[model samples]
Target: MTETPQVTGRHRELLDQVLDKWSLHVLDRLCEGPLRFNGLRRAIPVVTQKSLTAALRRLERNGMVERVVVSTRPVAVEYRITPLGKTLQDLIDALLLWTADNLPDVERARARFDDASAVAGGE
Candidate 1:
């Protein structure tokens, strides 16, 4: 019997950090061009300020997003995708496509599971 290779802890941690809803949404918005904090907020209107800030900070810490402080009166700052981040674009796109393809089946399975659980509990 052959054993399947398991994902490493480090890889799992990285995926948990990057695959979060806010992080994915932020990355998708930044795919167009650099955006200021306000711009990002506008682009993703439903995200709370705290959530956006945390996501951006995490990305910046991971060296995926570059934060530039422009020398202006109010100290304008902008966030852009780093080279590493650019590399993730295709991976993100592929993941999106995969999710789209699987979502219907996933929903159906969830509904079936829930129905079975309710029936089992009633017995």
Candidate 2:
């Protein structure tokens, strides 16, 4: 009998990192083009400066985003998708499409789960 391979902790960790809200938003914004810090903040209005900063730093460290200093007078930095990041574009688009197609079903399932959990005092 052949055994099936299990997903390692590292794979789960990487999935968590890539699928986070901030990472997805950052990647989506960068898909349009390279953007400065303020530009990214504008594109993702709900993200706090500190959170965005952290997200960008993590993405840069993960080799998914590139940070370039393009100006020196007052100092300016821009974030762009690395080749690896660009490869994720199709995955992101698939996620978007799946969400669009199944959001209602997901919401309905959530509502039902919540109701059941409430009745059972499990929520």
Q: Which candidate comes out best when scored by TM-score?
A: 1
Q: Across residues 1-123, which tens digit of lDDT does each residue of candidate 1 receive?
A: 989868999888888888898999888878779999999999999999999999999999988898999899989999999989888899889989999999999999999999999999999
TM-scores for every candidate against the unseen true structure? 0.89, 0.87
Q: Count clashes in each candidate, considering only residues at least 3 apart in sequence or on different chains.
A: 0, 0
* RMSD to true structure for each model, in Å: 2.9, 3.3
Q: Compared with the true structure, what per-residue lDDT tens digits does model 2 show for residues 3-121?
A: 98687998777777888879999998898799999999999999999989989988898889999998778888989999999999999999999999999999999999999989999
Error of 1 at 80 (Å): 0.2
What range of 10 consecutive residues in model 1 has the weakest lDDT sum? Answer: 24-33
Q: Which runs of model 2 end up more than 4 angstroms from their true locations? A: 1-5
- TM-score, predicted candidate 1 vs. hidden true structure: 0.89
In model 2, where is the ten-residue run with the lowest total lDDT? 12-21
